[model samples]
Target: MIRVKDIITRINSSSISRRMGQGLVWSFTGTALAKFLTLLVGIICAHILQKEAYGEFSMVRSTINMFIVLGSAGLGVTSTKYIAEYREKQADKIPAVYAATNYFGLLMAIITAILILLGAPFIANNILHHPSIVLPVRVGAVLLFFSIINGVQNGALMGFENFKAIAINTLLGSVLESVLTIFGAYYFGVNGAILGFGMGFILIFVTNHLSINKNFSAIHIKKLSIKKLHLKDFSILYTYSLPAALSALLITPSFWLIRSILVRAEGFQELAVFEAADQWKVIILFVPTAFSQIVLPILSSLHKEKTSFVSTLKYNMLIVGVTALLLSVGVMLFGGFIMRLYGATYDNSVPVQILAISTIFSALANVLEMAVYSLGKMWQCFAINIVWALLMVGCSYYLCMRGEGANGLSMAVLISYVVSFLMFLVYTIIVVRKEVK
Candidate 1:
């Protein structure tokens, strides 16, 4: 058996550890600035829009976001992996990879926008049951096209480790979004709020696109390999993105379903409270997310050569587990203040507490899910997530029917994550050990 002392002594020499530190420094800086900006926007918007209207506004934005992920087509992710892998070894291939990813993502996003535009009536009137926002939903389709393409750029930048450009883009985008949201809400009420939301995403796309071109000037139209690109290469890219897009297609509706269930059970007022607290969930998650971004490309590049990923996993568990605990405590103590940002109606704290508690398990799951992705096990993670999402819908529905309130829904989400974390842990162990064999 490996001895404890030897394991402890060798920790300092791990390459992943060193690289993690480097990636974390950059990622943390960007994530911090970006999340802070998002938080400020949410707070101000909540303050400006009244309770029910604020709820409606959040619903429109969240629903739009849910669909936006579908456009990623996994190529957004594959770009980062392929770019990182080939950056030094196959430098000429960079332009081909970039062009393929960008063009493919943009194409898919445009199609997605069309679909959203066509379905906005059904979604707003039927699924959302909030026909008042139908116009906003239609307007949001344009934003969807832009946002999905932006994901492609951001993913490519992540591959190049040009986090400074990514950070600046995010900071600028968030500030613009906040200003517009506040101004629109102040003037035109709910419709203005919706305008700000959609326009903000458009600004994000423009800034990110410009930033990527500025940072990676090698990929101009003249330098790209579009003329030489073959059908087989596009087919290969399609294969990479199919599973991701499929997952997004399923997952986005699942999220929409949960909010739908919650609103149906507890009303839009409670949904407002739930959304308000979720911002903090986003805040706490920024830490693990920063690490995951760094780890994905690293793991993708090194998966074949092999090393002990378990050590790094342990280090993350400690860091994220403890951080989650602290965050839960912080929310429990001061959650009221957070909800109060929305107004007196949101000041209820049970949902906030439940949501905060869930982040611990969710954070751990986020790391493992990404690790699984790194190992090329995308389908398993997706299957597992689909089940978890269903559980969120089913469990939340069953419990809320019993009069457990929004807390019932929140608890269901928390339980689903715990189950997911356990499943991922076991499956990952089996996969890793077998790989060694």
Candidate 2:
């Protein structure tokens, strides 16, 4: 018979649980503080900028993020998955792997950045339908390049489980970005705000580079050899990263399209309200997002241990699902007060409450998605994301057309995620059964 004390001792002695505890502590601390600063910056910007300008700022940022998928090309998860799986087994090949990822990431970044630069005016005029904001979109192009490289670097660190370094860097980067963005918005309005965001990404890229260098030395990877990268070195990119990248291609553009539909159907005022409520969604998810990040590397390491992997995945879903429910309830209870932070223009509570409820489904889907990633089933993941993205875009476009405004868009999110959670649930159960057998 097992006693409570024995259970406690066993948990404490478990290597995976101990590492997870340490990672969560640092991840929560840094992510919470960083997201708080981000929220603060948004509030200040909303108060200072006109509603239309704030809307434009939000739109430009979204467009940049859409393009960012091209540059990132799923390399972030690719790096994390491979590095975590291979570090102990193939320590000597770590440098080659790192070098190969960087080379491909850099090439993609250059191509995507140039594409954005050349196409900004067309995007502003044709897609966004606000040609006056062309320069801001151009500025976002620069941000895209640095942001992609930063994702790769951060992914490498996560693979190594260097949560302490990630936490410190995240804190410092958030502080710098908050100061610069606020200053820029104060002086030059929309364009300056976008420029400030670009500068922040540059700083993050440099700091991450420094951290990765030190991590390499600590892990006894003496050198990263770009010169020796061969065809085999790039197999991960084709096998895993391509499907992951294609999945992002479907999802990110769908979001940009959804926002575009809302903006065109209802205009910037409605978009501002949507963006305002969306900030809270970001805040509530940030904690769970941290948990997901920690779960990925740990799960990747346990991929060969089917029973432990299934147990870990179940535990993660329970924790994240419960936490999401509590946070959603809290947000609903304080909906009006939270919306008021963005000032009177965003005082509507319906959208906030609607998005709050959506968080529960999003949380569950995230855990299942992580399991797919850990098992290296990128094609299956992409297939699921296709359904997810299509539902989101279709529902949002239809609702926005029906004149429900921001509230409609929020409802679309809730609906899409509900279906997605069920789909992921069925798929994950099948996968787990097979693995356990």
Candidate 3:
């Protein structure tokens, strides 16, 4: 039997273990605080805005997230994978990698932002079927630009293992976002809330930019620009990012489509209940998310070491599984009370509980997905996400047509993740066998 004392002593003795412990502490704390602040803002919005209005805000937010997948072009994970792999092995090439990533990242951000801006009217009118939200959707284009830039920079910082900077940034950004969003929802309703969201992303982008500059200088990179594009490094990034982007294309838009179907079939009031439950899901997810962030960097560095990589992956899966089970239990126990915080209108508990169950599946699947990324097998990642997306969207559309509303959508999400987790498990086993051979 393993003893707690022995485990603690071992963690204290190993350098990598010590580093992971520190990163986990900072990442989890920062995520907890930030998620709390965002949840607070969400509660405030729910109280201030009517159910229909809050539903509209959720729709706009989902739409922007969908657009952001295009803007980011999967450069964030690509940045993290390459930076972590190269920073220690080929330190001299770090600058070229960073420069090429930033260049393409910026180019994609600008192009997607332009597309979102020009197409906002059409999206609002046709896709969302809420022409009144055009201005907010347009503002989200600005938000998408800053968000994409910040994502690449955030990934780079994580590669550097500078969790302290990320923690500080999360704290400051969350505070600012909370203030702006609360104030906006209280005063001007949904549009103001979205504008506040944009402003918050902009602030984080500025801070992340500063962090990148410092991280670069620490690594002896004199400047952080592409003076001459390195086609080799860019090609490598592109190869990885394409499948990653395609995976995002499959995932985000499927959720967006799910929401669209909900609104059209069941109306905004039902969407509001689903959105409320989703907030709690986000809260439950913060812990695993923090773990996944740490896992990516460590696993990326260990990818070439088959034994270490496989061992670490098993450990990560164990930790995530245990923690997620506990959180899901808490959600099941307190889901109704938690939903009531959003407002009486959100007091429905079944959807929240169903979503809580999904969190367990999601947490484990996410860890496996991150491992695939660390191994640089992104096409496999895309394939898994495509299957999950098809399952989710198809099930959701059918249920929405049956007038199931929040319960149906939540069930769809749960089923999709469960299937995705099983598939990831199979793929990981296959990869492990190949590594052994």
Candidate-wise lDDT, in order: 0.75, 0.86, 0.84
lDDT of 3 at 392: 98
Query: What is the C-alpha lDDT profile of model 2 across 123-161, one tens digit per residue?
Result: 999998999899999889978889888888888999989
| lDDT of prediction 3 | 0.84
Candidate 2 weakest ten by summed lDDT: 1-10
After best superposition, candidate 2 residue 129: deviation in angstroms?
Answer: 0.6
lDDT of 1 at 359: 88
Residue 398, model 3: lDDT of: 91
lDDT of 1 by residue, 1-437 (tens): 54545444444576666766777777777658868877887777777777788888888888778877877777777787777777656767777788888888878898989998899989888887888888788877877888888788888887776776677677677677767778888998777777776665677787777766765666432336567777766764756667666667766777677788888877788788778877888887788777667766766665655445555555666667777788788877887787777677675778888888888888888777766776667778778878887887889889878877667878888888898889888888777666622
Alpha-carbon TM-score of each model against the true structure: 0.91, 0.96, 0.96
On lDDT, the candidate that comes out on top is: 2
Please identify model 3 stretches exceeding 4 Å from their true place.
Answer: 1-13
**Clash count, one per candidate:** 0, 0, 0
Candidate 2 wrongly placed segments (more than 4 Å): 1-13
